[model samples]
Target: MRKLLFFVIIFGFSSSIQAQKYSKEVLDSMYSITQQTKLELTKPKSIKLMAVGDIMMGTNFPNDSYLPPEGKGPFDNVNVILTQADILFGNLEGTLTDEGENAKRCSDPSKCYSFRSPESYGKYLEETGFDVMSIANNHIGDFGAIGIKNTSKTLEKHNIAYAGIFAQPSTIFEKNGITYGFCAFAPNKDCIKIHNLTNAKKIVEELKQKADIVIVSFHGGAEGLKHTHVTRKTERFYGEDRGNVYKFAHTMIDAGADVIIGHGPHVSRAFEVYKNKFIAYSLGNFCTYSRFNLDGIKGYAPIAEIEIDLDGNFMKGKLHSAKQIDEVYPFIDEKKRALKEIKKLTQEDFPESKLIFDEDGSFTQQKE
Candidate 1:
């Protein structure tokens, strides 16, 4: 009888430990230690994610951001930080294929915007560590469906995957051998060309079934300014109002999305933890060289990294921000010390940000 009681006690203790393992607080604490972030990843462990927002490679493209025979872009400057993650992501704010019907160019340079990039250069995205890109943005239809088709084709040709819009396959996060499904919604209306209402719900539901975790991206909200804070109310664009981003993002979360990454407001917004998930309201511009936006305080882009368990529940996360310095027509900036400085300001912007400033004013990712 004593032997059986001992066995029961052991089993009960093991079950308790495992149950405590997944509590939201404990998982978040463990993720703080994984920011050194590596690929090939650890098993039954958390996965590190890196993301850039609004990759607007326009007429002012930088050499580092674009590959040869593609364009001159500075995307390579952040390659180290970006490539070190398990899978990297970004918002492809411009179409990648040249075959699409060109968007009607806005005449006002101050308000002008239309985006395209050569398809051949997609190899750079693969080489530079971008495993997935989101196509649900205003520019997805800039070249029309032909352009969207060409962009999807080029991404597939390069073996670089995408999600959110076009004829793209649902992307996933593969960590600890678990596949996580990805989907997105854009107010751009073009998302319907690829993901209709029925299909969008279907994909989200399917992701819940097939993925260890599900991440949803959405491009909805008014453009420009730090006033992009999302509420539980509808928003307007070009005089047409749309669903509340807060409601939409959380709705998808309830429907099985483990995380939510939102963009399109050319400015960054405060993030929150909802339903045991992390939601970055916006990350703004990462490698974009647009001479147009004068965000001033809001244009600085965040290099967001999140850690999640095999089932894609939020563990912990951090943001490494970078600023777009010049406002020139052809814009580009070296990211050498900029990363350090940008991180400093981010700590100011987000009091809860992991970065800590020393008494002497230096910043480090970990407080220890």
Candidate 2:
């Protein structure tokens, strides 16, 4: 009975929508309207968004051993769920530079982890259904400015929208009839600073004015298995300030961000629904091959699928549990470890929050 119910929910929610394309005149007219008028005039439609954590699909710059086979094996296990969404997003943990001088200095090579994937890997991301990627993480500058430029160029060549690099701090794109604005922030150098609350809020507000839905991604917070729970305060790691992720997320939501996705902590954290917006504290290491530590909790993550109304209000979501085994490709976890862990963390951290998750991984808000 329980299994049947789960399938029913999945099938019922997996809607196939064909967005009506508007002419340039219609789009311009829509943009010119006031917020209240726009909301009243817009037709409500369900928009599905899939978000995952850090993705460093095997880097071969330092060595060839880390590279995967010459095929689409990296995302084969998870591509089904990925392609189902209208928009798919994830944090690009490292640069996609084939050749460049590494900029990061490490005292101990054994402990340091820097990634640089081949430029050809950008197509693989597109094939795996990644429409937009966040390039604002500590390792994004592993190969310096050259790497950053190459990463942006490569993604653009593959028709993927990217943000949080160079002067392109935010990207606004339209799919179907819904306009989405995406921006990324991190505490690392050469990206939008997550610590600057005033600046962050201002950017989100500006994005809100242009797009119907604004989604913000941040790579901040302490890392490792020990950092599974959100402290709701400022966090620091290795003498570097990781920013107050709680305040940052809430502020972004208040500034008109419909969704907030966080990743940096290599472990999964809690989920919260603030002011009808959904926020995932940390989605953990979605797919970090070779160099990443994948022991215990570090390997657990969820391919989060979220559905929101045209007005950017949270509707429902599901967590498809996945885990990396032996630092290789990610596979669905039979035990649903990621889902269970998030449930526990959400209960402990936001006890009074309206978001409710069932054992089957489907989530909804409590009735008023």
Candidate 3:
């Protein structure tokens, strides 16, 4: 009876959705009126959205500046970077709390990288102006269901908003006059296994109607490979079942997603203009400890800032490229050269793609 009831509940929720079909003119007009957020109908005044790749706070590569030395890590540097944005975002790639004994990180502490950062890190995340953290990565459930539960608890305890880890509503967040959503999928069954699609689609479709802007984050695709590349067909990491990123992202956009930021391919993928919506294939590793298997171009990461006008519409943004050169004990530092290199690489990844360059490691779209 319990199992039957569960299926009924899922069906009930899935059947209830009224997705809005938007025309280009209406959307453009909406954006124009809310260009800088002057619309009273649906305006957020000012919305600054920032995103990075993976923040695998692994204990294996313990460092002082980047992560906490020991008990209760301090998120000072992360806060410093995030403070600048009104709504900061990133993929927290691990469980925050120290709970559960069922799924241990790995047998070998060293070389075993199931990130378990101090739950106290949420304080700095909140204090740093981070409005939301996407738990949709391959490590959100690293320690199993217990890890997901603990991570959610710790983030909430510190007043940090998170999504894409909980069952259904657990991964959905609507705030700041914008209905934001995230869903983390994986191809690996060992670490952070994901087995839900109805829940993911339901969340996206629902959020599209209720929120002014719907930002969907996906975490999948092959890792450490140059431009891992997204095929329209289902992707397999090592014959596992990494959903087709192209399909996943485009499907979400078609369902009224304003923006789609994906990260899982630890190396960046090409940014494409699909159906008039922007899709960042993969942002790569944001704050990682190991550079193993990382080649010349795969290690570069960028701090992407997407600015939505007052009406929650996509306007423009700057890509601030950065690097994590030192494998262990590294600090989040911006490399001017790395930014240029990444820009050039991005252009190459999508030969048909356009790119704009700037001095001091920043780039705006020439034709976004």
Candidate 4:
């Protein structure tokens, strides 16, 4: 009798049909409800994810002079926009340690650039709503193993997730009932190499099996204004292979990556839509305090807000323009320089791409 009652309840049958006998109307209603439930479960849901380029609030390694006066105030201007997204991401340009041995050997101490931000500054990232960060850039290893360890611990203490180093190649976390898998790669030591497509594909494939969406971040490409465009081939900086970003992005998408965010280059590159996924080749320098070159396009700080479905397909996006002048902080760019730069680069690099950028920085994929 208990089993019969369970069957009736499972089928959504009336109490009178407890005997497992149902009228045509009852059966039809049950089928309709089942189909509706399936449709609801299979429906695509989207989440807004905001991404930016290299972010180093201040470096105390050389001296405190490089530190910003406002400290956390550097992010105040864009906090409102950043908090609006479900996930906020940026590339941690340097270690969050107060002191550490300089990893790179430089004969001229004055010419050396080693960034070591205070550990307390991690709170600024948490308060600014940064859900995740990519610590797979060239500067991440500036202070060596100690720098890497301290930065990881600080981010963990602040409840922020980070990846790219070999110790923690990828991370899976949950937000609002959706699971996201994130992994980062770089061409630097102690970091996951972006050049190894075999390993990258394996990591992404495994992430796709366990997570609802997969996000891949790579700190590749040559640096500076002269290397702003995607060459669709391997890039080398000072004899280091930066990996072929064009090939890497597409290969990751094929491996089930939903979104790809690229950095390392200190200037925004291009945007492309392939296999229903969104890829930003480079976001440039978002918030770098003293010691960085803030001239011409190098100063442009663009915030890319991408809306993607549960399947990780691109829905729409927008680019918010911001720039750092002589100050260490970034302010809203009234001239929309970031938007203009990305538009020009994307057009020149990926003319066949389906992405359409408007004058106001709003973008969407062209319908098939």
lDDT, model 3, position 98: 67
Q: List, residue by residue over 114-143, the lDDT tens digit for candidate 2.
A: 898999888779888788899999988898
RMSD of each: 12.4, 15.5, 14.2, 6.5
Candidate 3 lDDT trough over 10 residues, lowest sum: 59-68
Evaluate model 1: give its TM-score. Answer: 0.71
Please, what are the lDDT tens digits per residue for candidate 1 over residues 240-334?
A: 65547777766777777787887777777656556557777677766665444645644466677777766666666655645664432112234
Most accurate candidate by lDDT: 4
- Model 4 Cα lDDT, one tens digit per residue, 82-183: 889898999999999966888888897557898899998998998888988999988988998899999999999998888999899999988766788999
lDDT of 3 at 61: 33
Q: Estimate each model's TM-score.
A: 0.71, 0.87, 0.73, 0.87
Tens digits of per-residue lDDT for model 3, 82-192: 567766777777767666543545566454556666666666556656666778666665567877787888887876666664363434556654555544444445322
Off by over 4 Å in 2: 1-44, 107-111
Q: List where candidate 1 sits over 4 angstroms from the true fold.
A: 1-44, 60-73, 105-112, 172-176, 193-200, 327-368
The 10 consecutive residues of candidate 2 with the worst lDDT sum are 15-24
TM-score of 2: 0.87
